[model samples]
Target: MVTRPASPSSRARLASARGTPRPDRQMAILLAAEKLFAQHGYHGVSIRQIAEEAQVPLALVGYYYGPKSELFHAIFEHWQGTIQERLALLQQVLAGPPTEAFLRQVVEAFVRPVLVQRASTEGEYYAQLVGRELARQTPETHRVLTEFFDPLAHSFIDAIHAARPGHDRARAAWAYQFALGALLHHITDHRAPTLSRGRNQVCAPEAAALLVDFITAGIAAVMPLPSSLSPSPTASPSPRRRAPSPSTTSRRQA
Candidate 1:
């Protein structure tokens, strides 16, 4: 049987509740989970530890979230509002049609929220948690990536592809991947300032603009695939490996 979508009224109500002061029990569990998951990985964390950190009974953890994977997914589901804002911003930029500045616009759309999150108090834990999980690349993390991250990425990739039709699909894909990689790496690396001798920092307000400029240039640098590699009208014949000369073959066989 088909299921109806959530009504706008119900959605807004839920959003309001989530944004406001939630019950201590649930928020405690989620915060605990985020902390533990950030410190230890998904595999390293356990339901018991989460319960301990939350200061709630172990049963409550199970009651609130059926399984560890579900709980992990819930952490992301809790943050859907931020993701929605990013998508909305991207959609607005896309509506303006392609231009020379399209790549910069797309990069800004992707990078701004990320940098914003990196700078905010609540967002610090979230950025760390997300970066750690992504780096871990465990089976559960893979599930999260597919369920939440890939679809969002695909949207931006499509926008990038549309903006630069001259580039091949492979290059467009690479550009998107590179841009995301840079963003995530910057967020995850807390030692950036120390490592750079205090010359560079990743979480500054202007960081997003700098990243946008760099990423847009990187995306633009993808050279088109060579003409020889392009598909031929008639099926291109595969090059045959030359058979060894009879004398050389006989000598080798001997």
Candidate 2:
């Protein structure tokens, strides 16, 4: 979401509209919006239901965050740090000389931050919200992805091309899209544990490693790495984005 935080005066107006200022009010509204929007599609949630979920006046939801679309945009805006961190990790991997682990590191640079988010209490709802959005194809879904995620998606596809010269960039992009579907399904679908008879719990910490395995293998199918590369110690994979705590003030506004 390109939406940034409101100014202090804007916050004052938001609080005044509610007839009381509570510092947690805006964040509460965002959390509620994230949950409801994830469980229900964008069209399915109403501002009044969000207010009820957050235990705030219905008017406060509008004053604090505006309409449903704005609230949806705010969720991605609130997680803008995630996009930045992913970019930073990608650049770090590219900065190093290419190595045996080059493609795998590139995939991790893209995937780990999402998994880190899914594992956190604060980010779980948001992760599911993102999952819902990614699974759809509408003007709003296209807008959100194009505005907030397309740049990142391009960066990763370009990196994939870099790792395997002569691979068509368009194919690389499709590979990225496929990997994203698998990643999101891991978080949103609970059938893994059932299918595996409890051996493949998606919420378990090791599930993250499993996701990387599947994604890296899938990417290799699209952009096959050379058979003779050697691993380099300099190319360590993960540069994780630390999840925010409950009191962690958002870097942007709702």
Candidate 3:
């Protein structure tokens, strides 16, 4: 028997099997840039490094994203979808009564996506990148981070006020900040198991739920009603004792 030449379809299949399908070049560059930018501050990473990490030509990074700033912006845009999910859930929550339970749901909607992303390999890098951006807090990166997070934060703050009509709005804002601090802490340093010496641990699924609980309770704790808003106790008149006092005086004199 003689060996036969492979058909076109078989050849394509062989090529595909021999190598993994590559992601879109632009997207790969952004992803690689994000991981590097997160590991090193934006100022510390170069287009060349991103290209090398992405396994693409140095010129391709510039061709796709133009410059380092634009490449960084692309990472922000990539996460826009996640922000949209948060906003949609927030709108849905706002559509209903702003009860405590609903507020917790809103908190879950805001934070769960971020924590869930950490559970995946790619997402882990993204989360680290976000945390790093926060730490660096240069004027440009600060503006970029704020542009994405501030609007979402305001919506939640409004919902929190609606949930407890009498709660202090200023305190509620502080609570929002505190909640963000907690999330950033988790993202940058997830060493709970080490801290507890392995007695306590938080898995990804549990992390979201626990965070919702912690933040919701924290908000509730901080946002107490002002005295003006609190219900006043009813005042009662003192009982009349004049007659009894006079009788007792007379009896003592006799």
Candidate 4:
């Protein structure tokens, strides 16, 4: 056979013809998978479905992530990392005197990151995913709450307790719950009908301040004084037994 050599362009074209996709395509697949998984529960979605939504090869899902479970975990990890970065930045800003200022900082730290994400293109979708997972109370979500969320809540509780010395632990816990409930509801609901009807409004930064103020006042109002610190009022002496009333005794003797 007559020998033939491949031209540089031909070789380059051959390489280009290979099935490998660009990095952005892989990211699109992941993003699509996340949206689907978030919309439908993990068990409700399939790799093929994600591939179709992402417009990538069906096998690409498994190629990028070994299994559906891995892919699910990856999506959560990615969102959590983004949130944590914002949290870390806020924490740095909060590292100072423990005053109302610090409390405001803490509140902003907790709320701003998630709120900012809520305003992004992916934020609403991802937040819905988080809400669904939270509502379902899945094992993975529970683990994330325990590992990431609970610690942050406890830290805030401790800070509040310290700032208000006489605050009872139970009351502090309740106040923390109140603050968290407000934030959670806002995120899950996004002040929809309430704001839509002009009954309520939610400004991200201002809401943070309001939550801190509401929680701090609630804690201050309900928290009981420490037992050791509470002073007992002096009681008035009871009427003297009258020593059997000397005049009455004398009359009885007569």
Model 3's TM-score against the true structure: 0.74
RMSD of candidate 2 to true structure, Å: 8.1
Off by over 4 Å in 1: 1-22, 223-254
Colliding pairs, model 1:
none
For candidate 3, the per-residue lDDT at 16 reads: 44
User: lDDT by residue for model 3 over 91-132, one digit each (tens)?
Assistant: 766565423366577688778777766676677777777777
Q: Write the per-residue lDDT of candidate 4 for residues 111-153, one digit (tens) a residue.
A: 6677777777787667777767655556666655555556556
| Candidate 3 local distance difference test against the native | 0.66
Among all candidates shown, the one with the greatest lDDT: 2
**Model 3 weakest lDDT span, ten residues long:** 245-254
Clashes of 1: 0
lDDT of 1 by residue, 47-163 (tens): 999989988767656656768987888888877777777777877786664344566777888888777766776677788898777766577777667666776776777667765
Candidate 2 contains a number of clashing pairs equal to 1
Residue 252, model 1: lDDT of 10
CA lDDT of 67 in candidate 2?
A: 71
For each candidate, what is the lDDT? 0.69, 0.73, 0.66, 0.59
Evaluated at residue 188, the lDDT of candidate 2 is 77
As a whole number from 0 to 100, the lDDT of residue 206 in candidate 3 is 59
Candidate 1 lowest-lDDT run of ten: 245-254
lDDT score, candidate 3, position 164? 52
Error of 2 at 249 (Å): 31
